[model samples]
Target: MTKTFVIDGKTIPFEDGQTIMQAASAAGVYITHLCHNPQFTPHGSCKLCTVNVNGRNCSACTFPASEGQNVTNISKELNEDREKITQMLFVEGNHFCPSCEKTGNCQLQAVAYHLNMTDNHFPHFFENREVDASHPDVMIDHNRCIFCTLCVRASEQVDGKNVFAISGRGIDKRLVVNSPSGLLKDSALDVSDCAAHICPTGAILIKRTGYSVPIGQRIYDHAHIDAVALASEGEAHDH
Candidate 1:
């Protein structure tokens, strides 16, 4: 017998150590999130995955799912809150989707679409951030960084490089390279580094691979992020 929890009336089974977001994703139940990746430790920074657990709001990515616990994931008020969080991400950075290389493949844009966000509700920050293209094979467009720290974790944990880190605090916070000069060229990051590929936004990108996939044939263009995982699993099984 498996232990289970109720999320939006859906009974989701989970192992002892699984969080609500983990159990939900494993069950093919999509709970909205941004700063979450199965390969990395749950940061729960994005608050987009916030859900009502036992009548109180908690981050589903980090909240443990107990047997018989009632979790409210999708609802009118929750979706509205999610929409605001998504909007804040947009305004906090210069996320100009039209001209961005990660447009269709971007998780931020995809999640915005998932939340039915038609406009940026908050005022744009338009903060002038530097774009570091000094690295031969990679580029860092700080303008699009959502501060998810996926790259920071990937570099430190997987690549064992500790090549990326976040600096400052709150509105003044920004990504920094691990180098004496604080430049990508001074760091040891390679194109094959997991950190190079983990960014969910256009903040980090391969140098010469822009627009490699046609806009119409991009990942999100063909399927929503919620279905992409399951669809990819199906394709892998076919192979």
Candidate 2:
């Protein structure tokens, strides 16, 4: 007998040690998320993948799937909360989509479109973060960072280089370079490192490759994030 759980009335099978997010993805069910790379350990910081498991809200990316468990992912209240979270992320960062090179390819931007976010509901923080152009092959635009820590984890776990870390606390939390000069150029990051390409926003970009793909022909411009994410799961895992 196969064990399964219910998500929005759809039964999803799960193997032992698999998370709710993993099971749903395997079943072709989309769960909105950020900071969740199948190649790395799940960090439930983003909260965009929050789902009601047995009537209790939990992060689908980190929550384990249990037999006969009930999960609610699609609901009016949940969608509204997700939209608010998405909006807050926009207001908290300097995400000027039109001017950003990662506009259409950005996961954050794609998720916002999927959620139908038309405006940033909160007042803008307009943080005066720095743009580090010290690296010859890459750039770090801190202003657009949502602090998802994808780069941090990728560098540490996959690349075996602790090049990035989070510093401060609460609203003061920010990404930091692991060098005495606090510069990416001093770190061990190469253009091919997973950390270099794992950023969900334009915070970390490969120099000279910006606008290589025309605006109208970008990834999300042609397909929804759900499909793109599902299709990229294998590639992401192999990275």
Candidate 3:
């Protein structure tokens, strides 16, 4: 039997194990999110997908959908809060969009545009992070990492290689390479691994592929993220 839930006045159906995010995406409802990929285990690390579930906030990605549940996903208050969170992501990282190679195709930038974020609402961290160019075919620009952990999960789950891990805690947290020398060159990651291409930001990039599609012709250039997601990655189901 299919369980149904109400989200922003729309009815969505889900299988027994499906999450709210999975169901909403299947039902063609666009929710603001950052750290969610249907291919990975729902980490619920990014709070952008938090929704009011019967007066309590829950992450849609990890929260299982229950029958007859009322989920407040989209609202003026919600969008405003989400916008602020997106702003903090911008300032906390050195995400100078103009200088970023993933400007047009970046999910963070697309989510910012979707939420109508205009200015950096908080003070910039300006912390100097490393740019790991030690790898022969891949580069790690730590300044652009949002700590989404897609790469870490993809490395372990998809590529069968434990090449990345998150270390430290809170503001001191950062992505670390799994190698004796703590560098990508010494790791087992290959250019063809799914982990290498799973980064949503410019943090992990293939060498010599910058601006190949040009600025105005990139993936998110001509389409809203929601539409693009639907067309390219519609109705995500577990494999």
Candidate 4:
């Protein structure tokens, strides 16, 4: 059955139980979002798609639409909030896109561009992180991780292997392999494992295909976050 709700000043009908993000994507009211792969479960850690639902800053990826509910995806308040979040992602880690392999195609970079973030307002954490190159097909750089948990969830849900898990306290939390060996290659992960392909950063790069796609053909090659946001709007119109 379909339910009626308000989104960005428009009253629209959506299927009951569908997430606000799904509903917005269906309606083409695009919000600047990353860390949400429709192919997998929503990991609202990015905070890029935070929308005001009945005055709460809830993530669209996980929030269900309700009858007569008001959902605001883009507003000054939300834009500022998301911008700060984007800034945090930049400074909290080392996101030097110019030197990284995933520069043009990264979702984190795209969202930053969409939010018009040219400089990080916060102090850089500059934490010392390690890279795991033990896996034959993939590399894991802990420094680039924003703790989105996409890889951890993907491993369990899509790859059918529970090889990744989160460990540690607050700011020091890290992704750990579920093996005594600790190394990714020693962790018994295959090339086809979701852990090899689900990362949004250069952190978990595939070993051999590093330069397969040229700079221009990358996912965000010609598009900025603003362009993506606009494209989402156009896509909504197609529905």
Each model's lDDT comes to: 0.90, 0.92, 0.89, 0.80
TM-score of each: 0.95, 0.97, 0.97, 0.89
Q: Estimate the TM-score for candidate 2.
A: 0.97
Q: Candidate 2, residues 102-152: lDDT per residue as tens digits?
A: 999999999999998899989999888899999999999998899999999
TM accuracy, model 4: 0.89
By the TM-score metric, which is better: model 3 or model 4?
A: 3
Q: Which whole-number lDDT from 0 to 100 does residue 208 have in model 3? A: 90
Clashing pairs in 3: none
TM match of model 3 to true structure: 0.97
Model 1: residues with Cα > 4 Å off, grouped in runs: 230-239
lDDT ranking, best first: 2, 1, 3, 4
Pairs of residues at least 3 apart in sequence or in different chains that clash in candidate 2: none
Q: How accurate is candidate 2 locally (lDDT)?
A: 0.92
Q: Whole-model lDDT for model 3 versus the true structure?
A: 0.89
Can you write out model 3's per-residue Cα lDDT over 137-216, one digit (the tens) per residue? 99999999989999999999999899999999999999999999999999999999999998888999999998787999
Best-fitting candidate, scored by lDDT: 2
